[model samples]
Target: MAEAGLRFGIQLPVQSQSTIYCEHWETEAGPAELAQAAQAADRLGYAYVACCDHVAIPRRLAGAMGATWYDPVSTLGWLAALTTRTRLLSHVAVAPLRHPLLSAKQYATLDLLSGGRLLLGVGAGHVPEEFEALGVDFHRRGAILDETVQALATALTDEYPEHPGPRFPFSGLAVSPRPVQRPRPPIWVGGSSPAAVRRAARLGEGWLSQGDRVGDLSAQLRLIADVREQSGRSGPFAVNAIPPALYVGEPGWDTGRHALTGKPERLAEALSAYGALGVTHLQLRPRSRSLAEYLEQLEAVATDVLPLVRS
Candidate 1:
């Protein structure tokens, strides 16, 4: 049912094509192209479709970022109307930028409207300029993020939520459109910093690895295991891995030397290594030059690869 043993999801291509993970085709992409890709993923049985969050890019980082981030809330909401089963995720929303009540209202509406399919992944944001422009102190972001997660957990779960924190204090006000999911959606914590890992261990339903390699993932998994055990946390916890750039099948051109290219079974064999190391989910990407090519890759993974891994 779950592609054998592990659950897999993709960060939809056009939403936040940062240069680090951007494909050549994304530069030429627009809303139509994005909708097509998101719909295809839904059809192909991906466990979830993840969107990224970033308010603005500083001039210094714009070149590297490609300046093409669509707001996660708007993008996810747009695509949610088009798909049925697959869950929607903010791969890592910057919760510190906005008050938790606002975040709760927006995402709770998303969950309510999307038939309760929402996983609210959150993170400590990294951009100095973005935080400065929003009037939040950058150096205090880690603490702020911790508090934000606590606040969001409360606000998302209760019909009439209250948050009493140094930055935000409120009560006696009711937030409407309670999430369709009873207690609230799952909160997966993101980032690879030491602080982030601890927060996830202590607070999150899952850990979203930012940029850790396979070797790094194994170590991170071990560390998380230790942290959870040490803290005596008994709730459900998940470990995520973003593998090397994947090429689902033989390619006519060089996508890159690091690309995992070969038969689907071969690729599954490589990916199973991550599963063996206790990773419960993977956020995979494919190398492609067009939406058609990308969808083909998705189809191949769904058809040819996943079953073999399960076997």
Candidate 2:
């Protein structure tokens, strides 16, 4: 849990990327391995464990890219069972893959089972081919995502939710077992676009920034803050940023671009810079090839890095 007025979290790259920025880290993380990693994170006092949500594997970037992705809902359901404290999240579930009612039901069960420990992060997806493969119109996803957000929120509340929208309609239906979080879960809107900022101000709990671009992150967050203020919402809405990797001590790890690469003093300085910029949460991850390397990175972060900056 956060302080009385603020909340913070970390993101785990649970999809197990084969290569990031064309450099190989861990090529594969099996189901058991993922579960163990989640357990380890819980033991380390992390607040959130987030997984990338994808319906189909994108092709040919790496030879090992096609390995089975552990489904976020199923994986989180198990993670909730395995860990008593850590919250589970889909970093950015593609909104067009599943119907809003079904998505609401799935997350509600997970939230209930996890004792309301669910942060529902959603995104208007990229990857045109993935949408084509999923049999959804790639162009109209923005409208669809808007409807999805509203419908999910409604379905999580009223037993017989009814909506006649441009995208879809739901009437005379009961989506059972409302989420453990009253009204709905904390729906985080991700992306750096203007639309994303407006959406977050209008309907989301926070704006989750992605990728390695810090200048972009700063500007987007400023826009979110400004928009929220224009809308007359109070301050202290979450501004979350995920650094690319926490690979401290790795050769050629750019400390300039990412906050989590460097010795304790340097990392602390970088993190303080984010804090100065009004970042309430900084989500860090370690880039490594094996379990030993991963744990080593985590240990370095816990021992050398965390104490330097954690509030």
Candidate 3:
């Protein structure tokens, strides 16, 4: 049940968090672990189960972040199969990586399989190496993402769907199994750029602000507002901010800017401040010393951090 005036969401970091974690466990959450995480999140009343979509993180983050990349759609389909209530979402699937028509079909299939639980988050991918791996032109990916969104919007419609898009082209093919969500499954545009803001306003239900500065977010919000107003849209749009890496010990915490890094009460205050600014969702990546530490942090977040935000 949704709170009277609040909604909370938790994003799962599906990427490999370990250097030696087996490759087979990369995609599926090992069956038992997936079940446990899903059951736990569902039991705790989290609204959505979100995941990141990356073919691979840049070489620089090989040590800092994990290497194994999981397919979010397939993983979400599995999550949906296991969990009943939690809506399945991808933080941002790289749009230029797949055929828009194919993605539409796949998501529609997933939506049907999940009983209409899908929030399709799309983005113009940033990694040039991944694009190279896929044989896609990295230079043209932004344009491809733009046109991909348009093609998707058109394909998800009921009426005559025809798009002579530069990235995707379809004449009169009936793209079957349209998304269960009316007017399409709540497309949220990701990335923090003027172009991204414009793309979100022009073709999205909201903006997915990932790994950005507070000043950058404020400016982007302003740009979103201007674009939305120009396009005759109104208030109550969402902005889900992914705060900076929050560690347990940081000196002189102000609690005004970045999300808190210390106690639950402090983190709660930071969440509340974002909420006060009309931020509907706060997605945090827990700092972990080990797998044990990750689970400990997740437990604390589920028990202590989430409740304060909920309140």
What lDDT does each candidate get?
Answer: 0.85, 0.72, 0.71
Residue-wise lDDT of candidate 3 within 22-53, one digit each (tens)? 22333445556655666666766777777778
TM-scores for all candidates? 0.96, 0.87, 0.82
In model 2, where do residues sit more than 4 Å from their true spots?
1-10, 21-25, 58-68, 232-236, 249-260
Give the per-residue lDDT of model 1 (tens digit) for 218-243. Answer: 66776777888888877567776788
Q: In model 1, where do residues sit more than 4 Å from their true spots?
A: 1-4
All candidates: CA RMSD (Å): 2.1, 3.3, 4.9
Instruction: Identify the candidate with maximal TM-score.
Output: 1
Q: How does candidate 2 score on lDDT?
A: 0.72
**Backbone collisions counted per model:** 0, 0, 0
Clashing pairs in 1: none
Give the Cα error of residue 154 in candidate 3, in Å: 1.7
Least well predicted 10-residue stretch by lDDT in candidate 1? 1-10
